[model samples]
Target chain A: MKPQSLLVPALVAAIALLVMTDPAMAYLDPGSGSYFFQLLLGAVLGCSFALKIYWRNLVSFGRRLFSKSRANRPSEQQDGPE
Target chain B: MTGINEVKGSFRDPAGRMFRRDGVLYRGIAPQGLDDYSMLMSSGLYEELCAAGKLIPHEEAASPQAPTDELRFIRPREIPFISYPYEWCFEQMRAAALLTLDVQQAALARGMCLKDASAYNVQFVGPRCVFIDTLSFARRQANVPWAAYGQFCRHFLAPLALMSMRDARLAALLRTHLDGVPLDLAAKLLPKRSRLKMGLLSHLHMHAYFVKKFSSGGAAASSKNTRTLPRNALEALVQSLRSAVLSLKSDESSGEWTDYYDNTSYDAAAMDQKIRIVADYLSSKAPAVVWDIGANTGRFSQVACEAGAYTVAFDIDHQAVQRNYLDALRSGRGNLLPLVCDATNPSPPLGWALAERDSLTARGPADAVLALALVHHLAIANNIPLESICDFFGDICRSALIIEFVPKDDPQVVRMLSMRADIFDSYTPERFESVFSRRFAIERSQRVGDGPRSIYLMTKR
Candidate 1:
């Protein structure tokens, strides 16, 4: 699935998790809002990044399978012509 | 501390404070900053950044009289003229933002992260932006989201988005918001279409939402949860921000004065003669620094730069400054800096106690000033008296002034007069020379070709 499709659900889940979590224990006040936002966004981006990697791997796997089938057919045609 | 004067703006970071002694700049690192300072040096980050020209190079100096609390002292190379973000055009600000990110990434590569991402930490030394605050880095902690994420968003991303999507003039907002434009305000001002941009959505709109949501609850609502961010995720987040910044492009349509040189009243021969005359004056004086006020697209400012003087080309029009900056970058003119400044109301001393940033005049006493074809606008258009103008120039330039006097009968002046009543009875060449004579002595005077306009090279009295 596309990253955009996963965004709303990820956002909702993060917000829910944020609501349930205890008050933050930050040493440096990067600003309460900014710190929280970074956490929430970091999770969403992480998921999307993982999905992108998986998607790339799946595409490469499919491409290899198709190329192997084509190569077998070319050899069979050569054997018939000989 | 006896002879050293602490730089006021440097006190914000307790890690170290920049001070000047005997007219040389130095950074005093307190005992608290020792660990980070040592790490910054030993981790090879310092050498890498210095070699890349991303950071200002400094040398450790022995100062026996250094403050008792200071553990070490290092002197940084001085920038010719210190310019604030408010004076920067859209492209210049964008360049600074990208440079900040680049430095942060480089720091993260070596188990370090920027402690703070303030725009003030970045400064332009010519056309290139360099991260000036050597003490801004800290050892990176595992599973901690970049601590300066919010600040980076506020200082760089917000203003850039507003400028690119809304209006270029919105950059002046930095002058008021010295810390950087508030994220909430930036979110409000941005066009609705910006919400469609994923980077803008997460970094700006949603970021502002969280800030407002948590602001009222204070520290109680602050992030108490220890959410772990994988190193890959953190890198991805920074990459996202970089993409956001890269996506922003300034409106480069020719501004009112961007094409000024092409449409000027002077013929080609007259323009050439004026260039030669200005070049002659600059070469003869050999001033170390030159300020070209009313430098429209920096035509004559180039002459000053080519003469081997560090030149600051200031113009009121944002487009003009933007064009001039791009040209400087393309030509690799390390001696030229183009900034937006309204001569009538130049940048004033700003920030805490009004000492954090230097005003235009406070930064100057430049070796020479080029006021070519500028007096009439100040005199006739702005209604500033010639004496006051002369006084202003005298206060800013130390040695020489190459100024042009446009007679009332000149086509440009005539056009300006046509729109408004010609009440400038004292705006004559004779009045100009007499009034200016109080501050400067006329060393040479030559008319541009046969035009009614005359250029004067004056020595300050």
Candidate 2:
């Protein structure tokens, strides 16, 4: 199942569990929806972490292009309007 | 004239003449203050103002201490607690800022104007802000443009604006800038967007600009003769500043440590039972002063105060402290005072080589300490062992400790461990009692309602 498709059911089940439980004596290990949110968030994070490697190479290429153009120019405050 | 020790600093006004005789503070009125002093007292305004806590209470000299030509020298009752402006929380500082303006406005209405708008002149009477400088008022001069206007902006406006516009932590800047933070520096620190506000632009940015521009030139010095605002405009300026100050509210509804109250295991019944137990204990112990540690919302501090003991309610939460302070003011509660303090890292001996103001530990060893609902957070959250917590309490106060123990099975403890690992395998009630019993003999322990938490009234061994 797609991670996004399970989000609604996971949230509904979490809320249902929390409402039914009363924590007077001792606190629950985690509130009902907590695990669902955590798992979903972990999946999203894992995908993003993989994407960062590709973005880093693109960023370095842009930096190299910009630096080479900057080094070709004179370092001076050119005349600008007040 | 019999002389007494003089207090230093900008208080050198009234002619470097503050004297402490037999532990009572007295400000000697210079010859200039003679007529105003007579008008202030004989007019019955001093009595009226002091009784209302609007002005510092003073009584005319019983002994004839005035010089032959000098008017009467009066002695005002000293404030029970002398807290400097720097030590005040954000709400306290804002209330003081507004009070100084109120005093100026009232004095102006009485045909007098405050000579200085120093934040040091105001202090908390319960939660109500009262002016402490009975002699700060002077007969108003026509067309003088309120000489105290610049001082007011520097003392109150600058610091408050910095707190609101920049960050609330900047209120501590008052500690460093005793004479009030420099307007130029405050303006510089504020984000550039704040300059767009008319009040900030005019009072801070423009005021600082003019101060620098004038101080550097001789023509501006000569121009002082030509510059004068009408009396009406001066009064309007005071009102404007008062509104501006009163409008600046704390950015956060709950200060950094507010969730603590919600995180606790206490239901309404458990809280009530704890208060009832503390009250009953106090009636028997009959201590003169009680220090309520981690006193959130001050519900139990009121119990101590109502029991005829002066209570100092100290809490780490700024919002809790602010709420407690405002409630005390609204209720006119004089016997209790709320201060912001992180018990773990309380205020140390500071100021003028560290003796001017007493540190938290230096100030305490109160008759008793109400450490209710505080042990678990210190033990589990802060990693302070239960036994060390008991020893720390033993060192601070002499007699009784009203503490609460929330077991690990309790929901609050489970919640604290919800997002974290359960490394505290030894956090059990039996173990807690074994460690704490080494120092304090547990006098009585009652389970709060049907909850797993129990309140203990322990006596130091």
Say which candidate scores most in TM-score: 1
**Each candidate's DockQ score against the native complex?**
0.32, 0.01
True contacts kept of 1: 0.49
- What 10-residue stretch in candidate 2 chain B is worst by lDDT? B222-231
lDDT of 1 by residue, B1-461 (tens): 46778788887778888888878898988887889899999999999999999999999988646336888989998988888888999999989988988998999899988888888888888888899999998877655667788888888899999989988888899999988889999999999999999889989999999899888666625344455555566777899999999988897666878878888989999999999999999999999999999999999999999999999999999999998999999999999999999999999999889999989999999999999989999999899988899999999999999999999999999999997788888888888989999989999999998889999999999
Q: List the residue pairs that clash in candidate 1.
A: A23-B224, A24-B223, A24-B224, A25-B224
Give lDDT tens digits, candidate 2, residues B415-461: 88898887777778898888878888888888888888887878888
Best by lDDT: 1
Clashes of each: 4, 2
Misplaced by over 4 Å in model 2 are A1-82, B1-11, B14-36, B42-48, B62-73, B86-91, B165-167, B191-193, B212-227, B256-263, B331-334, B355-358, B361-365, B383-400, B405-454, B458-461
lDDT of 2 at A59: 78
